[model samples]
Structure formats: C-alpha cells, structure tokens
Target: MRAVLLFAVFVALLAATAVFAYYGLAGPEEVALGVHGWTAMIIGVIFSILVGVGLMGLMFFSSRHGYDEPPQVRKDR
Candidate 1:
C-alpha cells in the first residue's frame, strides 16, 4: 500500500540520518558532540519538524476551507 511504502521510506531516511550523524559527529578528528550539543540538535530538529508540519496542516486547512480557491467575478445590474 501507499502508506506502507511511505512508512518504509521514512524509516530508511531516519536510519540514514542516524548513521550519518554518528559518523559526522565522531569524525576521524575524534570530535564529539557534548550533551549540550545533542540537546540543541534534538530541540532544533523537533522545532523544524513542528514548523514544517504546522505549515502543511495550515495549507491543507486553508484549502479545505476554500481559502485557496480562485476569485469570483461579480456583475452589477
């Protein structure tokens, strides 16, 4: 189903992000992210996702409420 495919893709992308973050944070230079760094990262990611979802929800709500419809022309008698 479409939902299953979307879920699979989401999981794959999440896993890929985790792998990249792990490697990127602890690179060959032995750099590491501290607790504060991680906290900030998590908060930032959450905020970004929330903002994106909120915008998408608003867009859908607007469309459903007819705010996205074209203007109508009126004729006077």
Candidate 2:
C-alpha cells in the first residue's frame, strides 16, 4: 500500500514537471537546448516513469533476495 501511494505521488509529480517543461514555464530559450516544448515534456514524463519503475523493480528484487543487510555483527565478549 505504501509503495503504491509513493508510486502514485511520484507519477503525479513527474506529470506536473512534464507539463511545466512543455509549456515553456521556464522560458522559450530552453527549447533550443534539446527537445521542443511538448516533445520535451512527453519525453521527460516517459523517462521518469521508466526510470522510476525500473528502480522500484530493482529495489523489490534486492529485498526479495535479501540483499539488504546490516553490517554490524552481534557478539558476546
């Protein structure tokens, strides 16, 4: 549930960012940097979704495989 909530929030933020990026809210001068307004926005959104999902999958895999562990060892002196 928490993961789903987090993913939703992340996607929403990415969508907002893409909208801003596409509408030239930053400025028209930025368009020449690479992608144009709408194109750049769409690309940004897609990239965000891909990267976010990829990372989540990686984390899930690591957790499932028990790759995450504390380095500290317990001992009786």
Candidate 3:
C-alpha cells in the first residue's frame, strides 16, 4: 500500500513536470541562452542532471542516518 501510494505520487509529479515542460515553463527563457530551441533543450538537460545528482545525494545522506541500525541492534538478540 505504501509502495502504491509512493508510485502514485511519483506518477503525479511526472505528469506535472511533463505539463510544465510542454508549456515551456521548464525551458530556458533568458537572453543569454540565445532564445532558441537547442538552448532550451540544453537547459532542460542540465537542469535534469543537476536535480538528479542532488536527489541522489539527498538519498545517500538520508539512508545513512535513517536506515542505519542502532548500536544496541547490532548486538546478538
């Protein structure tokens, strides 16, 4: 049930991102990028990669603290 809920949330987020990207909200708009399609694609790719790395780092840190067993639990039960 928890997995299902998580998957649903993930799907919802994906859908939202797709909608935003489709409408150009997720694309680059600054003049420094030349205001072209290729620039938009590059920006999107860069944004995705940065977000992916940040999320991975967060997962690593959270797992280290949240999923680690306590010292008491390391002993034979």
Q: lDDT: which candidate is best?
A: 1
Please give each candidate's TM-score.
0.62, 0.47, 0.41
Worst 10 residues of 2 by lDDT: 26-35
lDDT (CA) per prediction = 0.93, 0.86, 0.82
Between prediction 1 and prediction 2, the one with superior TM-score is: 1
Q: Please write out the lDDT profile of model 1 over residues 1-77, one tens digit for every residue.
A: 99999999999999999999988867777566779989999999999999999999999999999999999888784
TM-score of 1: 0.62
Best of the candidates, TM-score: 1
Give the lDDT ranking, best first: 1, 2, 3
What's the C-alpha lDDT at position 54 in model 3? 100
The per-candidate count of clashes, in order, stands at 0, 0, 0
Give the per-residue Cα lDDT of candidate 3 at 73: 50
| lDDT at position 56, candidate 2 | 99
Give a tens-digit lDDT track for model 2, residues 10-55. Answer: 9999999999887765667644554476688899999999999999
- Model 2 CA lDDT for position 17: 91
